[model samples]
Target: MTEAIASEAASNPGMQMKYKIVFLGDQSVGKTSIILRFTSDSFDVKYQATIGIDFLTKTVYVDDKMVRLQLWDTAGQERFRSLIPSYINDSQVGVVCYDITSRQSFENVKSWVEQARQ
Candidate 1:
């Protein structure tokens, strides 16, 4: 399911384009936190597992062009793995996050990449 968030128009006077960015990773790997940091510049210390999916939008200027990024935060639990392929198929960018302190999370990067590719 797609969740909509308020989006601001880009400062550039030309036509704006929308890009979909999806974040993927193992549970507790900070996927939501990273997107929150980039979109709101705030981080929550509390840990919360995301449900199926959560979405947010942020407008950014790239090369003096206005771009609207549709950020999709996905659940990392194995139970939700089946829902990821549809999101990946629709995304223009996929960010795979992992906990720096967890060796297991690091090792799972390949698996995440393969999922995103599929």
Candidate 2:
């Protein structure tokens, strides 16, 4: 269940670590944008709703240890709510994002967090 990437380097060879991070929020809350920005350092102005779920992996060095981060982006549509439980079951971290300009989206954070907790 753990998605890990091993690193072979002179300093720290054959070290493997993985972390699953799930993003949860309402539609158009910029979850995708946040992941894209961190993983690729780029953002697209065009808005595309995530269908069901999307995943991306990025490897980074944390305190001289190589760690692979698996980012899970979940759809915010009401219909896709059922699919979230499976994703949350194995996730090590859950991030709930909301648009700062939208009060409704901000208010939904509590529900999203509760869902992730379950």
> What digit string (tens of lDDT, one per residue) describes model 2 on residues 39-74?
999999999999999999999875566788899999
lDDT for 84 (candidate 2): 94
Q: lDDT of candidate 1 vs native?
A: 0.86
TM-score of 1: 0.86
lDDT of 1 by residue, 1-118 (tens): 1222113234335667688999999999999999999999999999999999999999877656667899999999999999999989978789999999999999999999999998
Lowest-lDDT window of 10 residues in candidate 1? 1-10
Name the regions of candidate 1 deviating beyond 4 angstroms: 1-13
For all candidates in order, the CA lDDT equals 0.86, 0.89
Superposed model 2: Cα runs more than 4 Å off: 1-14
